[model samples]
Target: MTTYSTGGEAVVEALKTHGLTTVFGLPGVQNDWLYNAFYDARDRFRVIHTRHEQGAGYMALGHTLATGKPSVCNVVPGPGALNAGAALATAYGLNAKMLFLTGQIPQKMIGREMGTLHEVPDQPGTLRSLTKHYDRITHPAEAGAKIAAAVRAMNTGRPRPAALEVPMDVLQQRAPIPAQAPVSEPEEEPVDAEGIDRAVSVLAGARRPMIFVANGAQDVPEEVTRLAELLQAPVVGYRTGRGIVDSRHPLSCFLPEARPLWDETDVIIALGASARSALQGWGKGGRSLIRIDVDNTVHGRYGQPEVAITGRLESHLPLFIAELEKKGIRGEDLAEVMPAIHADWKERSSVLDQQIRYLAVIREALGEDGIFVDELTQIGFASRILLPVHRPRTFLSTGYMGTLGYGFPTALGAKVAKPDTRVLSVTGDGGFMFAATELATAVQHGIGLVTVLFNNSQYGNVQQMQRDLYGGKVIATDLQNPDFERFVTSFGAHYGRASSPEELAPRLEEAFESGLPAVVEVVVGDMISVDRFR
Candidate 1:
């Protein structure tokens, strides 16, 4: 079947064929036709109009992070794209599967620099640098193939953001689009049998081994757990990899607990994650390292590993387990040692009592399968190593980007993706205000997200650093915050206040039960810094 369609309509049709109907974006004149296409297909799509372009981008990120599926975000070119730049950078950093669509100036206005509406000097260059794949749609006929190609690109290799720019005039142009064809994903590269045998040889002979996981291993939790149990090696996760192995699993360990074990281990199996921090911080002397990742670049990121397998974890892990089984290898059981290590880490981490207390309360309110979006705050810092994650994708972080003010908007997106699952955003005074206006977006769209605002009346982290490093002299760290009660209520959201963790428990419960956009303000003074741990 063939149909005459505008470029915008063609793009929508292509995306729909690819099973993407939810779009997060703020409409503008440059992309008016795209919005029109969206409106016509309203019954087939869920259009989330956000307060800002960044909110749209972040929400798209949250959707993908929670579901491990590709997400879409659309914005106008120039200012709109620039507004969403931070989120795009963060997406790139986290290797998120996101499709970024934007409207360019008129088709003939390319590189003319006439000060036209939403014109940027080098929009294409900027986008290409930010995403793994980028292209432009010049006519309606090109929309389907280009959109399909973009979707395919993000899904393949190391999953990252992809971009497509359609000029305003092109969006209005009409052309014949053929029936959408299935967008076939690229085939996984053959697993390296030689690499797998070498890795297994090292694993099979090791008395003590450690398994480190990151986002790459997120999908193969069972395989990772099976391997860990078979080897009796503790599975350690930090940041994005935290919940790959359940915390209740005897083999599960956090970075803090794994430090001592790192020195004792004879071999390390790094899956879908680079143990970069461990090598840089703890030193990797007297240890043979095996790195398995889809991206070959990661194989030599820090230094060459003893064995590097460049293929999907889904492919390589099973091969490794099968090869080890053939060898009948069994590793030392550290079931008893893990508990002792965790207890020691607990006593050592008591300096972060306040953050831990608040995290515990929020965890209680979130129940078993809820998601927690973290910010670049004191509590957020503690969460990286201290929080107990029971399931994969339950914990969301900004990864290496360390983005501030991403918590609230990201949580809103998570709630949008999984409406039945409770989602909580933890932010501090400074970071919360960055995308604070999104509270309106949440309330208006009926996104029930429980945000725990830690109000310290300042940039707590910077102030603490200033005091500790610069002899108590602080500048511009103190904030004159609005009455949070009024601020939240003004947006027609439920508001609760707490002075301590005990008070926060009931407030969190109330916020979750309300089933509305809610904010729980937890007031605190100067907090103990978790910077040293990092």
Candidate 2:
């Protein structure tokens, strides 16, 4: 049956049909009709009005990461779309599932060069560069199908960001609404038999094997743990792959101490992990390698692999474990070696007393279920090894993008998605300022989040780099921060300050338990260089 409906109503109906319950965005002139439709349907949808387009987009990204469900971000044309681009890039880098809904100039004015409000030379092209797919709704009738297609793109193989642009005229125009078919996602392909056999044979012959799990392998945490146990190999997770195996497991190793084991291992199993700089190009070669990933292009990009298995980790891991068990291959117990590794790490931490102590406090406060949103900072990198993440998706970072202002907004998104779970965002003073305005959004929405701002009164990362590389000359690295306590209190939120390491734990505990948006500013010294580790 066909029914008369405005393009705005069609878009709203499409989103609702596709199971979009929450949307984050700001209102603007070009997108007024769409916003009206959302407002009319307010009872059915929860709209979170953010202070900026960037925060809205990031909140959408954070929501997806915490719930493993696709999220939506709506924005106006031109400037609004541009403002949201940063968060879109972050989502793309992390391979997160997000749908960006943008308003465009009327169809007639699209390429007229008539100086329309919020007009860009080629808006679709601009959005295409940031998302996996970009499409336009030329007519009101096409809104449902196009929105469905965008949602499908976000949910399909190797999930990524997608955008849909609707012209202002089309949104306001009336057209007959057609009944739309339900969105159906394509099934993932099964693991190849030959690839599975090769992986089994390689593992069967290996003596000292190591499994490196990446974010791509997040879905198969139990299988990864089983495989690690069966192979008796040390398991190491990098980036998004952090909690693939319980970090507390005796065989589960931290990245800092796992380097020595990498040198001794005869075979390496790289699962859903990219060979980024952090892994030092997958470490000095010469080891038998088995690489598993859904993306085929990632294979042999860094290190030559003996076998490349292309499929979802959830599907391939169980098969690999079954084959290994059939062959009677079991991993050696490393109960004795774990303690020595811990001792070495403790000795190394003696020089970073304050940083270590602050991290210890955060770890104790967050416990196992708390979500930690990390920004690029000295302490951020340190927590990768010092903190123990027992569950998947509990630790969120900017991934390969290394975005600085991402922590606070992303934490807000996570809290919105998982309200029952406690969320904390740890950021450097310089990075926190990028999204500091989000404090209002947090307080307004009652999104209780604990932000631990490490204030060294400078851009510590670059400051240290300049000292090491440029004759100890520091340029453009110093920062003058506000009184953090008063600043947070002005927004009707709780605030705490820790001038020294001893005050960190109690202050953080108080702020986190305050049941409001809070900030804990911990005064710290300049970052120590990696040369200290050597």
Candidate 3:
């Protein structure tokens, strides 16, 4: 056999086997090996050029979140790897299963103390403190297996980002092994019958049973909804479980205000919830708690466990529901609460309804099954309250990282991943333009991702915060723009504009059905937040 492939080739081959088709990266001197690997492997995956290394890292993370696949990003050693720190940290909180491949200065030259060109005194050790896993390969041939192992760890277990460092020389050297199949996540691991029975016992006896679902609930979204129905539990989603239960649903009460929670609160049933990790430890001291994911290592807020079920969320939740049913612990048939919940939802919907003249028309025109992936802050305000997406994953918002500028690119990526989904990105004017170039990519891919620009003419959140905390003089926050819809349309795409409620509906409808990468700019009124959520 010819000995041509090197360590870098092995890593690229492993990534291809895992089904990654596109990788974002910036090349540098120390990364010549992987850079060459990327070019040679161009047939399997395309390299997306990024202006900034950090942007490339986040783009990969965003792709992972949108597709539920490990996205790869290549970075050279030292500053290049350091540039990815912030983005990696954000994805870490979001539970990103991304594979970040970086190159290291050759091992021999690393510590010559010559203060080499790309010297990072202790790159792996430094990054290890910030990341979930960081693997450095000293051998060329083992690159495939080691990289696969890192990906396996990242995809399963706690589900976070993993990094690998390939030495420049080794990447050019011949590898001893060939690429292999990645280790697959197990078929299933159900919730323990004993734990579920115990949890059911607690809920059945309680006069007031409340359910608090967190970001982790998305793993078993159907089970989450079913459990809420089974228990007549007033369902509330944590910041991460935004799309699991329809915000429009009477049971999804964690919106605008924490009213449903304060009224008649008693036992809080947490399924796939991490009190500490989810940052919901507050207000739980007085309330009794029953947690499903019993992995204490998952969070610091692991309180005195009343009931702990150890299993995968998809399996555990179903088993938990089965056990509850067997225990004859039927959810309280509080039709009375349903009516109250419905009344509350109707009132909130009406408030949103009043504000819909500007957006509702466009939303309707887009059609019911239209997919809306939201930016972090805007989506929280608009989509959850305005857009009205009832499907899980259809409304992709930041549950953990809450990163901005994720709007444009993520919509582009999601549209590509789920080609059948009618993808739209609803974004603030400032946020939309951040990764606006992805528009070209979307067009190139032939995916018509509709873009809605919330033209508040400023960094709305910061300006709003200023108004809330300070006297709202609006310093350095407002952003200037040119009929951005026109700007995008000039790039050979459909576009529209709406400044008043009268124009919003018609323009939105027209734009959605137009069938191209379109943008509709909506100039929002100075409507101070009509409602707030904790």
What is candidate 1's lDDT per residue for 397-490, written digit by digit as tens?
9998988888888889999999999999999999999999999999999999999999989999898988999999999999999999999999
Give the worst 10-residue stretch by lDDT in candidate 1.
Answer: 180-189
Counted clashes in each candidate structure: 0, 4, 7
lDDT of 3 by residue, 66-181 (tens): 66677887888889988877677777777777788888888888767678888877887877866688788898777767877887777666677888888888888885665478
Winner by lDDT between candidate 3 and candidate 2: 2
Q: Where does candidate 3 clash, by residue pair?
A: 141-176, 256-532, 361-505, 362-505, 362-508, 362-509, 365-509
Local lDDT at 123 for model 2: 84
Query: Stretches of candidate 2 above 4 Å error?
Result: 278-284, 530-534
True-structure lDDT of candidate 3: 0.69
**Model 2, residue pairs in steric clash:** 230-331, 231-331, 232-331, 232-332
Candidate 2, residues 1-534: lDDT per residue as tens digits? 898888988999988898887999998887888888888999999888999999999999999988778899999999999998999999999989899999999888998889999998998888888888899998889998998888888776677899999988998889999977669866777678799999888877788898888778778888888888888888887667788798888778777667667677888788888745434644646788888888888887877788998888878888888888898987666778777877777787677666677777787888888898888898887777666888999989888898878889999999999888889999999999988989999999999999999898999989888888898999999999998888899999999988776788888889877989999888888866544442
TM-score of each candidate structure, all chains considered together: 0.98, 0.96, 0.87
Among all windows of 10 consecutive residues in model 3, the one with the lowest summed lDDT is 275-284
Off by over 4 Å in 1: none
